[model samples]
Target: MSTWLPASPCTPPGCATHDGPARHPLPAAALLLAGCALALTGALCTPIALLLGRDHRERLTRAWAYGVVRAFGVRVRVVGRPDAHRGGPGVLVVANHVSWLDIPLIAAVCPGRILAKSDIRHWPLLGPLAALGGTLFVERERLRALPATVYAIASALRSGARVVVFPEDSTWCGRGPGGRFRPAAFQAAIDAGAAVQPVRVRYFGAAARRRAAAGAAAFVGDDPLAASLWRVVRAAGLTAEIHVMEPIPASTVHGRRALAGLAQSTVASDRANLPAESVHH
Candidate 1:
């Protein structure tokens, strides 16, 4: 099949999408083969990351993920890069969650310790990888884990490391109704006087959407990592545009509820008027 190119700008149905072609499965196979080669490199580098201690290790892991994405033919275009100038002892980068791919994407943009669900800490390869990255595990029982979770986020922030959280608990397939946002992470920002930076991502191209819709996008959602990754590599390359909206100051927020409202509203607004050059804080 020939590749599809938009003579004019095309809008993504249901949600905003980028444009590319209907890639041949062979290309995806090649991408996967390249990915396997990278995985071998990871095996060699991971021990080095661990030996270097937690901080450097996670940074190396982030770089590895970004490299894998590049190998898979995923091009990430970041809009409104976060204001790193806003000197940060404690900054909370909060974003919408769509796929497990969010981790690598987030890591690429802002290398930070993630607040992953405790269950993921038990997964096969990912569980250990995440742990090696210094990810803070959060048990669903907020009461039982709230104190520790808060402490971990605080420490990471206080130590000059950013804390990335997906306010939305689960990944949305972009087909059905979306879910509500959990306020715990945002609340932590308010408590620690950290700025809540919001990032919105639009996975572009018809080929990408079909792959995502058919459960082929990279993420920890219902689709298995290996399978989803296979589909993404097989499809035409994807153009991902990320919008880093303005940061919300914790001082002005009442609590988590208010903070969440601000975040949700900001992301929704950005998506509605996407492809913007920048959004000032």
Candidate 2:
């Protein structure tokens, strides 16, 4: 189903003045140290979580994720609340992908199994932690593996585990909405009678001013993870905004394609209203 929402005005990239994050860098390398601590902590805690059961493991995962976000010194603000009923299993969260930081930020508010690329399972320090936390990794490059991935997501939902999916399939600069979300993941929610919640994530300066300064937070093209971490930790007063829109009942949604379209439109409309800063200033 097509949406009737008005589109956000877009100017040519160079034509638009990009207002970046305010000039405030941190004094020490706190995030890097925190990363080390979280990694070690997660590793030590993983086995304990497993024996505790899935619910306990998920709780521990959320705690670890929240600590990681705080360790980076990034502030997180939630605009809307996740439905109480949709808070855990029986709910599927769909969000716009901006940067690597999106994972930790999302975990703080809505914690569950996240559908991520397979590479994350091997990242230097964070990889094992993610695996231990019960993340479902997908080989996005392998088209044949999609059905298995979708089935995994469906199983998670059917078991009442909230699965967060990034429909865009890739990162965006957050200047506007990214590419259309692939509908394949939505099929999981449909098969399992779950509600799909759309989450919009964006970055801001300590002042919380809306602007294009997302580059300070975005992990796009050629930007390495180390560099992204440095940029984030060095930037003082950075806050990630999480806008939680109402969950769409998958029970009522007809097709996966239509479900994806509606979720995409919801995110795009919310993004258009965000306050942005002029980069040229």
Candidate 3:
């Protein structure tokens, strides 16, 4: 693996476990179908949605993203407002990765250009839709392509477009410290003189059980996408909380490394303050 491709120690048997009561098989199956139908509808409507005004498209995107999570039986609760950075430079929205749900959940609140792995471009229904929706694809395995990817992100930011990135480069189980934020993407924010918006995403059960709900939502290390999808649909009363912290001005930081460190610490501090759970053995 390229040094740029950081691997997470998190895996299904070691880090993931279903915590909450599960839905009946029949209900879970229905929810899964409903979620898939919503995704398909969104994909089919993308071409026509593109013709609408920017504001209209943003609203539509938000609604469609919100509907996808809801259809999967996950309630979304956003805490704190995102920095408007009104009439300012573009914003780099960074968040930790845990589950596939993180994509739609973040987009529901802050719809922007998603920085995704190139492999996602070939995904069945989502691949075409993501391409149409202006997702920036990065070839993680090709070190030679890194510079080009950075240029593309910087170009988008220079155009005053918000770009969302998962700086960790890998998904964690969301029960412990997540992978460190790679400093590479931070270079784009610096190049474009953009502000870095740090957002912390957490999953919890109906009774506020963080550990259980987080595991159910996590899609990590060799966990099949189909299995993760079914696990989420069958999970009862799972809620995804999005905490949008203050935006850090890239100019205030010395460089990309410092900016990346600052953003990572900002998120880590918040996670540390959450009610503690017994260490996973």
Candidate 4:
């Protein structure tokens, strides 16, 4: 692995422990089937979505993403206001990484070009779908390629495209400390003079009428994607909450490091404000 490549200490056995009721086998299977069908339907309609205008395409993507999450029996609750970036430059949407579900949850709210690892470009069904959706893949293993990747993102932002990135570079269990935001991606926003929209993503489950961290939704460490997917469907009352923080203008920040620090602090502070009882041990 590259020295600069982000890695997390979280492991499935140690961190991915569900604390909520599990769905019946039959229902879980049915939910999994429904989720797969919805994903296929979305893929089939991609050509048509591309033909529509930008606004129409955005609406379709958002609806499809929302449907996918719902089909998996996960409820979504979004807090805080989303910055529209009306009459301004493009906005870079940065959020904490937790689960694969984070992709759709974020898309349901803000449909944009996703910044993903280049390895995802070779994944099974998702690889093709991501290509169709105009995903921006970064070669994370090659630090020498970082400048070029940053340039590509800057170019996209300059064209007024909303780019979603997980600055953490690796997924966390969400129960413990999240990976810090790498300053590299923030440079793109600074280059394009774009606004930074920091979002905090948390998964919660029903626990005695109180919210508890939904470990089943985490895709951290070496957990198999299939196992995580199955766990998510089997989870009962799993809710993914997205907290959209105030947008920070890149031009106002002194440098990429400062901008990254501000955004990370903003997200961390919001997570800290959650009720003590809601946090899972």
Alpha-carbon RMSD, each predicted model? 9.0, 5.7, 1.8, 2.3
Off by over 4 Å in 2: 1-26, 53-59, 85-89, 122-129, 206-209, 275-281
Error of 2 at 169 (Å): 0.9
User: Per the 3 Å backbone cut-off, how many clashing residue pairs does candidate 1 have?
Assistant: 7
| lDDT (tens digit, per residue) of candidate 3 on 1-281 | 68758998888876667867889999999999999899889889989999998778888999999999999999999998776536556889999998999989998988899999999999997798889888999999998999999999999888878899999999988877788999988999999999899989889996666778888998998999899999999889899988899888888999899999999999888677665553442
Evaluation by TM-score, superior candidate among 1 and 2: 2
For residues 85-140, what per-residue lDDT tens digits would candidate 1 score against the true structure? Answer: 34556578887766655666777667677888788899887678768757889876
Which pairs clash (backbone N, Cα, C closer than 3 Å) in model 4? Answer: none
Evaluate all candidate structures by whole-model CA lDDT and list the values in order. 0.64, 0.74, 0.88, 0.86
Which is better, 1 or 4, measured by TM-score?
4
lDDT, residue 205, candidate 4: 76
Please write out the lDDT profile of model 4 over residues 1-281, one tens digit for every residue: 88968888778887676767889989999999999899888977887788998888888898999999999999999898676646556889999999999999999998889999899899898788778878899999899999999998999899888999999999887855588899998999999999999999988876452233557888988899889889999888898989888899999999999999999988888566554432324
For candidate 4, the 10 contiguous residues with the lowest summed lDDT are: 272-281
| Reference-based TM-score, model 2 | 0.82
Candidate 4: RMSD to truth: 2.3
lDDT for model 1, please.
Answer: 0.64
TM-score of each: 0.76, 0.82, 0.94, 0.93
